[model samples]
Target: MSNIASILNESEPAAKPAVEAGDAPAWNSTPTTIGFGSVGRMGSGAAAEPPKDADAAAAEPTKGDASAATNSKEDGPSATVPGSAAKIASGDIPVVINEEDMEGQIYSNAAWKDLGISDEIHRGLLSENYLRPSKIQARSLPLMLSDPPKNMVAQSQSGTGKTVAFLTATLSRVDFSKPEQPQALILAPTQELADQISRNIHSIGRFVKNLKVALAIPRKIARGENVNSCIVVGTPGTVLDLGRRKQLDCSQLKVLVLDEADNMLDLNGLGDQCLRVKLRIMPPDVIESVQVLLFSATFPPKVQQWIPRFAPNANTLTLKTKELTVRGISQMFVDCPNDDSRYDILCKLYGLMTIGQSVIFVRTRKSATEIQRRMTEDGHRVTVLHGDFDSTERLELLGQFRAGETKVLVTTNVLSRGIDVASVSMVINYDIPTKPGPQGDEPDAETYLHRIGRTGRFGRIGVSISFVFDQRSFDHLNAITTHFGIDLVKLPTNDWDEAEELVKQVIKKNSAQASYVPKVDDRQTEADDSKPEPAEAASQSTTSTKKEDDKPADVGW
Candidate 1:
């Protein structure tokens, strides 16, 4: 077990008293001070701090992407702040998140603008409107761009520019001068994510000459079409399928990136599919020749089990801030009467967020479908997705969601991992997942974070409402809040009638929208098509419409 697990074991959920209405969770106790709960009070919560100990959620090794620094034994401390250090070590909430925003990190201040990279690559990033490299990129790029390339495992939260981090690494490493023969292979947990990554990378690297990148998503590209590229970003399913058919070969694969590895290992009902990908990797001799990179937002224990099986002693980097609460995003825990009441709450919440994007997460595919049907029947623009949907269907639904065609999305945990769509304003956990780690083959806290994080991104405030129906669900939320170092406010609900309006009010209070739903460009033409038409997204993006003779050899995403 990890250190967090051990610490959590020492204290039961019962240690903290119930939260008072509208109060933040207490991060003053032992083990309740990891992320946002302790940052400096900039707006409403903790105060900010200096950059000396930035504690970025994913701290890259300073030396390089090779190894960790050696630990030293200290004798006695008679330093400048022995008194202050003692207070922090004593588990005081005041020191939980020393939100010391360092104003002078080289990446934040200097170095990148003078990176000395080619003008074309720089233009590519600017054209894509990528303002700047995230903290992860600024710190790791220097090392990643240095010499024979290194195997790295970068752990950062969802939507934190991790995709670009490795994209930069691969772009710098891959020899665009040579034909594309799978010098690097990128694996994602789902087809839509793989598609998004492929598209984003293509757009960023558009200015780079002679770089042929092909996606391995189903129906997008067929095997043996004589495509060439130094990079291949794809879902595990498509990559494995191509390799098995001898259409795609990683014999010359120099780098293997398992983006969102935790999600693959923890995605609900995707264990078998993911395991098959590992089995399809280039044979033993070829596998030993490649450097591996694993990345995720949260690396809970269950998904960690796959480390030994996939990565070869991958170097681990973890960066976490002390303050754990996302003060900008007001969080609430509501007690529901039952399943029916929970559904009612979501319906009411949808009315309040009529102009904003929302997501409702369920525990299973069946529930996702049922809830989606009920909501759609009630005249809501919503869609449902789960492992049950084929790769094409899933990709299409994702397109609609990203395009803002559908105002709300109700689905299983499939979209929860590293799928970034910035417009999401609220996340409703209709059925809170209680498992800390996966059991049998269900997703864990690592996957759950992907769900809630879909909102409150890009400095925009958002809200997350979770319905706690039973003791198990309540305990799960308590454990999750304790781990994240956020205070949980519990609201009691009596019936479905009142629950609806209450849900709507909570959603409206956090969203920035004032009235009518935002108008977006949705090209589809169908009505019971109340759901975003997955067929339409696939039809427009794919070349199936061509008489098969005009199809191109390479189309990424």
Candidate 2:
């Protein structure tokens, strides 16, 4: 075994290795680690002193007088431009760089000055105590701010400063003299994300004189008013309508960004609308000169194949399927008695862990409403938000959650992706996320990743507890765990006192280190061997994969 594989095997129960892609060579196997050691913390430059506050640490690192050697590699091997098969064979770069070496290659202990951003933008970053560029920002800013402006498809884990990276690119492309003209357009999959991007822009670009940003979500932009702002952020449908109506002129557009690009490009979702906006709305001249940027945390295989066509000749950065799971969050699951008893167990979770703010993800609006009502009656300040709420109401609900007015949020899939709240310390999968598959319904691994990703923001210690009350739910959770090659420590719902102490120990250990490695002995599920036949069999399966034939199958992505 390789050193990374050996390290992982020593730390947790051994999982089946991931299968390499069909066309790739032996050296291109899935990586077992992805820079878990340095996530969400400042490098050697700011190691002497800690961040003033969590919010300050969460801020995008575009400021501070720290020094590190600038990475001098140009836009040669790493940039995944079109027709580059020979480049990979020449040993210039691997499709997926080793996660250990990735930090040195991309982050490289760099300062913001290395990118040559404007003084005004630097001042805005300083106000927020941004000590240095993050991993994503360090890799992407140079390509985004290149003289001729290159197109890019960049994917990093959630809450790793993707918003700041793209926002900085958008701000740098704007011309203050053309304040009333639309110079840049940023499209998000949801209104909440667009609003969050707008807020970040105002926070990070506060020092840029005459910076005006307009939101194109419903009711925010009038029917006939021109979108007269240097930068525009909105949903695809709203932005397309304004573009077709000639209210949002794209003639002067230089940079076009699609946040959550994977979902935006999925045909079952918003892909048609996005394509129309790119091909039908924007004029051909603007299309030729406009720089296209796509950003997301998870890119499904189908979408990955189609992305190169959408953003042709673009530079690409992506992670292997094994690397998709965030290492910082400690994931566990609770074995509830039955479906009906999950509610009482859910209420008991808050007392089990030290949570700053928590989000509970249900599968439906009715469940969300019911949970909100029950939790409110139980004396918890809770908020329920989903697609059923109007745009304005949704924004207001999110605002309340971010301001700490509501310590607990019950929501459906609407808040799953790209919405960042730094204080969220825990996430409960009330109903494990699922989607329609050929076999009726299967575990939605991507949604599960995003839901838990809402916590663990910027490398903070976060915990996700999934509830499984029945055989079907247990199997679904098992499939998800196998898909990611992750071992979810089983939390016993029968004993609150024991569970609480176990949870406290997990959190304390997680907070002290960048990676989570659970011990097999301590993590084994407590099975009811006395139960008859299938129940006893199910319990045995959940405990451990000791038998040779019972190991998880290798997944090829």
Candidate 3:
């Protein structure tokens, strides 16, 4: 067997020299150049002597084998799995290859052509450089596109191509014979997300003849105008209104998709609207025949319990808790001495790395405006978006950011959820997200997950740097990290050069670990405890501290 194959199948560790911390080689060094075998050169080496017997190898106690455990520990801290050696050796973020993910070879290994997609849609996918189906796409597509369509509730990590998976199924199911018939209805939580999904569908189905996609937004279509299109994408309110007014013909609607399902189903804002749309559009008799597909990066326990009622008897696919966070994202945080120092540290971030496009999320609109003004002064093209902006203005500003007219976007939770800008390589949590709880305010873990999810779309490498200035903020962040069971590497504000280097190292190490959990040290905990209290600093300092506006948005979800 090849070295890699043997390594994968072997029950015993290959004896090798152990190196201590100081003597250890650089993590990024090539495996072949060091002592480990390369993936490319796997079969080239001489064969090793055969084991004495299979019975003897089986006789050894695998469970609590001290020598085996010791060898594994001495090898490295990284997790071992098939095809992970190269990534571990090269210091790239490791991806877990699950056996269940590999069970369906036809969907997992086959190309778009092999999936029986149409020529026109296939051309469009190829044009956009989507060579094959993603994991979610591969698993969900066949089930969705089957002879008798199935209701599906899929929970995937952000940016794993959930949009395209559902889109493909929707496009494929559409009957072009009745071009004007609205066959597919996709509802998003926000107008921006709805608009973005509309654009993506058009782009993917560009070559299809008689393809009609209508945006059912307030100003996009007049009040009395009828929506006669093959597919309709819109916010719940607009969709609900159109359905209620009988402007949108849902009689022939074959598919109903809820993108960002958790947000849409949240009881606070759009949930009622979503339920109204579903009820108004689908009569009791036809509801059974219509396919329902729910997609989101998160489905919290509460949401998960509620989804079966929304999409009855749906085929559910979910990522385990440890696997919820996107593997490619390198999560870190900046330790600011004071709230004022956060702005200075924010400006320095752009110079520290090559950022394609970035989003900086703050707690309030006032801070967003301030940061935008300061960032503009620093010679960066900036765009600020918030709930205060009217729909038209919000659309225009988002257009500029999406088209790369502006590189830095500053906003509140308004843009946190489902906005997919492909080139966004970084997300800055200028202020950590929090929600009111019995103990005052606690970290909003779901919102934090969704906020950072903006950048790391479809397995692309991205970074999220959160800024924490006080004990409250620090405790919130710590809680969030603990909740997700992921490590948050600390970045110092004092030294730009040292901070930059440390950030790079953290990214490499964390990526290779693949597991999001970071090993915390006692020194780091001590340092966190020693941070000066914000109230004390405020009294001693000459500059008056601006009280942050913590007024919660009634419908920010």
Candidate 4:
């Protein structure tokens, strides 16, 4: 196992190995011993070792010094994974390139254990079976709960667990006993995400009781829904609707989260509405400020301009856990001379799926539907999903594909982020998303990351094939490579058959790091009322919850 895998296996909470596309090779497998030694032995147990490689240490992100709250035994328990004890006994440890880079090294299990979560909160976390906090959580948790939490801003790629970080911070500040008034207001960009977030809050605060988490959405109002829950997640229009009705009392709100603030402002004219909601509740005297949390997948000039209007004094916390969407996946781009040649290439790629798993991302809804019909008619077990599909149908289709029911799926951008299925061995950007606008509608590097990231996730290895049309497009591909600091290696493939064989050989050669993605059943149904809420939903819709414009230029962040 690589050092990353060994550390995960030793410290991660799951009892059985995670469901994987396949098993890792033995040579890359780790020896049983991890970072365990007697209390006084540095680099083992409780003792700290000096920095590892100097270069990597210098490369570490210089976020402010934020020690996780010194968690107690219950709050931050030692990992109980098998071999943890053996490692302590046999302490010849291997060090990372940046051990001092981990100085605040918040990924340690002790961080959460030391937080000293209340017995009730601890129980919730235990019931949910949370193994360890993501990097974002480790750093943000303590700071949110600090004596005087100055407002803060954090930027991390989506899926690094931004939601729970803020949720825990929000929950920690609330006096559960006195929540009759709004003590917290969470502003999400969409109705779907609002419901999703509400469900999570219910589970996390299950033991907290008396908390009235609520939902404000067009659906709720259109259907005349009543929400007694305190935490509210919804599109801006509906939230503002409730505020205008005086149904919401923001007077006591101590926390405000512009979940996806970038998207929040991208809403056609809704950004103004969101500001009004905040303005209505905030008192001018003494400048009564509420703790604010802002997260986004990409930070552009337009989005950054709106931050001050929402969180004027917030500190910024940037995270790079997902610097490369294909970090864990082997990637290559295939050059398809023309659209007609694509079908012939796909026919060959299909033969590979007969032996393994893969997905093909098309460019449009119409194309996805057409391909689904053609593939299905051609005797393929294929599923297609796009934005046009209703929520229920899309969810069902995803469930079906996730169960390993279908080997190949033809989808559009809907599959870009938030869905987790590590077994997928390949991703084909059937139609690469590029600047499609009349003059400048092409996608940027961030869009490229979301497209390819679907494959290599949760430490699993996968491959991405980007079909380039010309020298210009290949140059654009090169820019994507440079932007992420990843090597977009040229694959040895003159044809589709060769590319398919390449994937098989690659998977056999390099086993993915380790799989910690929760199983369908094992996935926490709700937040355990006992532990702090898991990082806020990565499904954040990224930060602000608004649908992207049909054209890429006006797309929501």
TM-score of each prediction: 0.67, 0.75, 0.71, 0.65
lDDT of 3 at 320: 41
Off by over 4 Å in 4: 1-106, 178-182, 190-192, 221-226, 267-273, 280-288, 319-326, 351-359, 399-409, 422-425, 435-438, 491-498, 505-557
Report the lDDT tens digits of candidate 4 across residue range 463-498: 777765554454455444434445444443365466
- What shift in Å separates residue 369 of candidate 4 from its native position after superposition? 1.9
Candidates ranked by TM-score, best first? Answer: 2, 3, 1, 4
* TM-score preference between candidates 2 and 3, better one: 2
The model with the greater lDDT, 2 or 3, is 2
Q: Which parts of model 2 have CA positions greater than 4 angstroms off?
A: 1-97, 101-108, 505-557
RMSD of 2: 16.0
Model 3 spans with C-alpha error above 4 angstroms: 1-108, 377-381, 502-557
- Per-residue lDDT of model 1, residues 1-557, tens digit only: 34333322332121222123443211111233322223321112232221222221221112211111122222222111112212222323120111222111212222335433456677777776555655445434543443334445555444455677677667766777785667888777556766777777677789888878888766767657634677887766667777777777767787777776654554333334555554445765655557677666555444544454455333334433212233445566666655557777677667645556788877677888888888889987788877777767877887888788888888655565534555677787887653433343222333345666676553445667777655455545544554554654443344545645555554554455323222111011110111222211100000001112111111001
- lDDT, candidate 3, equals 0.60
Model 2 residue 382 lDDT? 78
Q: Residues 1-557, candidate 3: write the lDDT tens digits.
A: 13322322232223221222553211110111111112211111222111112111111111210110011111221212112212222334322223234212212344676455799999988766677766666556655665456577666666667888889889998998788999999987667777778888888899999999999876788888999899999878778778888888888889999887876765544555666677656676556578889887666544543455566645545544444566667787776777888898888887543346778888777888888898888886678887677778988998888687877788877777745666677789988887656777667777888888886555556788998777667656655654454666566555778878766554444344333321110000000011111101000000011111111000000
State the lDDT of candidate 2 residue by residue for 20-90, as single tens digits. Answer: 24423211222222111122221222211111221212111232211111222335434212112232223
- Model 4 accuracy (lDDT, Cα): 0.49
Q: What is the lDDT of candidate 1?
A: 0.51
Local lDDT at 185 for model 1: 80
Clash count list over all predictions = 30, 0, 2, 44
